[model samples]
Target: MTNENTAATALILGATGGIGGAIGAALRRRGWTVKALARDPAQAAAGWQNGPSPLWIAGDAMNEADVVAAAAGTSVIVHAVNPPGYRNWDRLVLPMIGNSLAAARAAGGARIILPGTVYNFEAGTTTVVDSTTPQSARSRKGAIRTEMERLLEEAAPDVPSLILRAGDFFGPGIRQSWFAQTMVTPGAPVRRIVNPAIGAGHSWAYLPDLAETFARLIEKPDRLDAFERLQFEGHVDASGTEMIEAVRAAVGRDIPVRAFPWWLMRCLAPFGGFPREVVEVEPYWRHPMRLDNRRLQRLLGNEPHTPLDTAVRHTLEALGCLDQRGTLSQAA
Candidate 1:
């Protein structure tokens, strides 16, 4: 399955992560030849226990030569790798992107696909943003994200790129996201749902659906521009309470709802990096940043979408929140 010559060949740079792994599986399901580059193939291959495996090429993404060599004969190179736990992220993100751009150029105009974030936008902007929105970053990560897209844009026709920008991700195999880290406790039954973005609208992208959208675009490269950016309007919880309601429905009961304790995280910020990182994104929870996907819908006829309750249920089961509760995940 790894080395077959298919109509569409994609080399996934971060196949062990949520977006990269999901997209790799989705593309493979659609008959694309998939290859993955990893520093430790044995450890990275464990991430695909439940799905088909990609050609696990032993390589590091930071090395331009490794990326360029692995990207040979590939039509798409997905730049999804990031510094673990945001450690040295600001210093490392751009160089990794530069390497991807170089690898794309080496592959003779192979498209570089980046799974983008809302960090590129101003915090709490109420307006729904499209692909061309002028990014005014509010934090250092946002600035880094903005610069990453700038690199892709500068690459142009020689190294055409696709940037599918979306909001927060919540789905199966995602353990570090807001849904897993703050919304629901991992490995524990749902006692009470913790909501950080209670009253404000928030854009959420289910990994399965997001991965499918990438596959659709990769299926037809003609629709893409030399350097294109498409905003995916995932499950828009216009009323921030919708997600909480969906969570309750997914578990088939009314559960207590609790507002996330941002103050506690702030108090503990000095003691650890995780809490400090969590405190920085409080603005997103306080305000809304929605995406407009009319451009995406028109291109694909319709954007891939899943019901919020179903998505939440699957995520809960994956996180083990639905365990010990008989037949919860099995219920329709």
Candidate 2:
């Protein structure tokens, strides 16, 4: 249970997403009254499929009035909404954050919690970064992310904000990330695992563990600064072999390991959309970067960590790549 035994209310903006759903479920488990903004409340609630029953408010994150209405009596506003299928982020990202900021002010200085990423850092530099790292990212998307945080920082004292930064996300509840796209083929048997950081190390954040960390942070908001960004030092596999080994163990057998086809991806980037966007951020995989979570460790006594083997096994099971016998299903 949270430090406060009283039932606190929270408004989640992206209740349907992986991070949002994970945090929402965690908060609900801690006796928090969680509410969400959705275009269709009934359909969104149906997506939960017998999970925690959060009050779904019919609205959109981009609409300021909708956001404010949803956050009426909430103490924390989780801003996890993102552009659908990672499209139109350049156009929609800031606007959505702007709406959330407006709502935060209207809701009487409600605390804002954001699931942050490593995009705010400069590429090909700083293998290990802490909360004090400068925001020098040069990529288009990274620049926008930096701007979003800037807005949050500027709104400090009025609208307190907490940004938990982490690396690539993987786990149940969402299958639209690098782990879901590259590491293993979703909804198929594990035949081959793809490695993006072939020759370098990479960081990965398990959704469940990260969500639990968020819940802990929310429990002790008094320890956090008005506008603070903390790094979640999740599983950092140096050389990328550790993660490959974990996946192999999860499959309970040897599987073909393939390197991501950066060559082909670069060639197809000209067509625009997801491919183009992915190719533009190749610097991240090429460089070795890991978040330093010492601060988070101090705050939470110790960051929540699930063993790689167990985390991988659960992820594979959720992705439908593993069967009851701990072997690959013959579906692929």
Clashing pairs in 1: none
TM-scores for all candidates?
A: 0.93, 0.95
Poorly placed runs, candidate 1 (over 4 Å): 1-5, 268-272, 324-332
Local accuracy by lDDT, each model: 0.84, 0.86
RMSD in Å for candidate 1, one decimal? 2.5
> Which number leads on lDDT?
2
Candidate 1 lDDT: 0.84
For 78-100, candidate 2 gives per-residue lDDT tens digits of 99999776668899999999999
lDDT of 2: 0.86
Q: Which tens-of-lDDT digit does each residue in 32-59 have in candidate 1?
A: 8799999999888875843779889999
